[model samples]
Structure formats: C-alpha cells, structure tokens
Target: MTTAPLVRRAHDRGIAVLTLDSPHNRNALSAALIADLTDALDAAERDEAVRAVLLTHTGSTFCAGADLKADGIGKGPGLLVGLIRRIATLAKPVVAKADGHARAGGLGLLAACDIAVASDAATFAFTESRLGLAPSVISLPVLDRVDPRAAGRYFLTGERFDTAEAVRIGLVTAWDEALDGILAGLRAASPQGLAESKAVATRSLREALDSGAEELVRQSARLFTSAEAAEGMRAFVERRDPSWAL
Candidate 1:
C-alpha cells in the first residue's frame, strides 16, 4: 500500500494506526494533510481487516492546529470538520494517542475520538480567539468533551492547559504512563462489541447536540461582534500580546 501524507498501518490484532507524518510543521492541518487523513480514515472504515483505529503523531507536537501560513488564513476548506464527523459516525472505535501538544484544531481531533489517552506532557490550547478567528468548526467537539463553563473560559481566554485539566474536563479519557500499553489494551478488546458500544454512545451524544446547536451558534455569533475579539485580533496582527491575559 502507498504511504500517504499520513501513514497508516494495520496491526496483526486488527488495530489500524494512523500517524500524522508532518513533524516539521508540527503536523498542522494543511490541505494536503486533511485530504490524506480523510482518505486514510475512509479506507480504514471500509477495510474488513481493521477493527479499531488509533490516531497518533510522530513528533513532539501532536498538532498545532491549522497551517495559517500555508493559505494566508488558517481555514482550509473545512476538511477538519468533515474528518471529525467521519470519525464520530464510524462503526469502529477511534482512539487518540495524544503524547504532545494538541492545540486548537488538534484538540478538536482528540475530542472527536471515542477514547483519548494523553501523556502527562500533553498540552492543549484554544488560541483561535487570540488570532482574531473563532474556533467555530472545533466548537462541536469541544462542547462534546468539555463543560460549558470551562469551554467558555478557555474559548474566550485562549489559554493553555495541561493534561490533568484535560482529563478533569473530560477531553481526555485518561492519562497513561505509557501510551503503547494503553493502546495495546484497547486493541485487545472485541472490535464488534466496541463498535456497537461506540455507535450507541455517539448517537446519544449527537442527539443532545442537535437539540441545542442553534442556541449555541446564536451565542457565538454575538461574541463575534464583541470589542474584545476585535482587540485580540488587532494585538495579534501588531505582534503585541493580547491584553486579555488570564
């Protein structure tokens, strides 16, 4: 099989590993990376040989959100949203083996997964507000994983948080001493049983979101017009630190 921008391998135990391969850019979600990731996930979903999918990266930083320099803007065709949706609906369970910094969009990817095991060194941030952009697409997974009050603080402040906070807020399922061991244990489970359980859980979660999504959007829209957001973006462009320091 051809190696994609994101590499994929099926282990003997029917566990498929999808490794984000762009280390130089901190595995930022470039257009090519997003396209390759979507394709790779789709292939894993279709392959009968695969049971569970493990998402990981091969660098010190798991992902640094979207590649803002690549396209002059961080937005990249909304591919991340589509990829997250695919993972959410996949029959098999998807686990994120996050060992490094998973900021902004990267946190969204982790949130979308059925289970997430983060290393103690893992760090997360929602820096979109600092850059004058909204974490609009990522808000879905963020809301799913984090409490609304916690989300408001991080979303508005764009502050960085540690792995323990991630676990406390439900973004990470657990913190593992060794990611390999956790992954091994997850891979040992019955794929069929895991798939059914994940499907039911995801369905319930989606229903809850569907019921209140409109109100969420309305509130976010109002925030877009706030003076703080405008000042934050201006400070970002001027190469000065934002005044809204936590």
Candidate 2:
C-alpha cells in the first residue's frame, strides 16, 4: 500500500496550484510535507508555462503550524525557515489563498508569499507563545509584512484575529470571497514582468531572512529543548493548559 501525498499539485492556466492536503494534522509542516512542497515548487519553477504559484488548503484549518508529534518544534525551525525562505525568494510570484485558520509557523508560510488573499472566513494567530515558543523564525516574514504594534499584540498574546483584522494590519493583502481576479491578474501579466516585480517586492524580506536565519534557528532550538517548551508542548498535545497558564 502507498501513502497519499500530503500536498497535491495541479496546473491551471499559468498558475501552478499547490494544495495542502493533509487535513488529518491540519496540514502541519511535517518533513514529508515540506519536502513535497519544495519539490512541487521546483517543478513549477522549471516549467516555462507556469507564471505563478497558488497555495491553498483542503481543510478547515489551513495549517496548524509545526506537527508537534512529528516535528515537535525541535526539528521544525530549520526546515520551516528554509521552506519559507524559498517561497520569499522564488522567482515567480506566489500567492496564498486561505479560507481557514493559520497558526504559528503556518502564518510564516503564507506571509512569505508575494501576496496572500484570505476569505472572510479565514482566521489567524501567532500561537507560538501559547506553546512556550516564540515566533522567532516566522518573524522574518511576518514582522516585515505587518504593523509592528499589531505584530507585538498577536505575537505576545496568541489571540486569534479575523480576516478584517489581518488585512487592516497588512498581514493579508485582501479578504475576498474568491481568488478569480487575483488568478486572472497573474495569468495576464508577462512572465518576465512578474518575476522582476516579485524580486523588487521581496528583496527586503530576503535580506532579513538571510541575515537572521542562523540566529533564529538557534533561538528556536534553545526554546524547544527547554523545560518550559517541553511542558507547554506536553499540555498542548494532551489538550490541557500548561502549569504556567493562569
């Protein structure tokens, strides 16, 4: 018997559709999933007909961050940082289309994209703090895209925010019912123009990640191996509040 892939890919017009299909774990970024996504991106990039990439999900939760059982935050930082950096620096425009919830490192994935379009039903949060972790790796992409004040609030509190709040804070590009217009726009643009524009737009984000990736990965490793993170992750996996929670 063969296992189903965590991610599925399809080509539509000039857009390469990469769907996160692992609903069982809320499409968490496991090693397998990340590898598959990276492979899909490589394939799309090599294809001359592909002008842009559209990232979407198949379940109620777009992504619930790292898979605690598989990744446990310990192994996730390096893998996640590499994947997100690839997205940030990809030559073609990558758009995230979300209609569900994105948490922790999952938020980083979408934020790394050139544009993120969420439906009104979409929700988001920086949930790392609640798990005795910081949004260290994700901060590279997220902080650059969002208002610092708002990032501080969500990053510290782990409070959930909706699409309207997301857009207001610049976390999401827009909250539309569908992505037809965005797809059409990408399809209409010339390939070279899209690549150049994406480069100009993502230059700063790329620089930030390039400069800080090592430190952030170290920070994540430190946090994940600590007693506090251990207890927090235990509580989370067991569906209970950590000892530190008031």
Separately for all candidates shown, the number of backbone clashes (residues 3 or more apart, or on different chains) is 0, 0
User: Candidate 1 regions off by >4 Å?
Assistant: 1-4, 8-12, 72-77, 178-185, 204-239, 242-246
Top-TM-score structure, candidate number: 2
lDDT of 1 by residue, 1-246 (tens): 955466545464677888888887899888778888788888888888887788888888988887755753433525666677788888888888888998877888888888888888799999977766677767887787788899999999889999999889888888866556766766677778777888787885566455644554455455555778678757866898878665
User: What is the C-alpha local distance difference test score of each model?
Assistant: 0.77, 0.90
TM-score of 2: 0.96
Tell me each candidate's TM-score. Answer: 0.81, 0.96
Candidate 1 vs. true structure, TM-score: 0.81
Query: Taking the tens digit of each residue's C-alpha lDDT, what string does model 2 give over 1-246?
Result: 998888899989888999999998999999989999999999999999999999999989888888867766566889999898889778898999998999988899989888898987789999889988899999999988999999999999999999999999999998765478888888999989988998899889989988999999999899988999889888987999999999
As for model 1, its CA RMSD to the true structure in angstroms is 3.9
lDDT of 2: 0.90
**Which ranges in model 2 have alpha carbons more than 4 Å from their true place?**
none
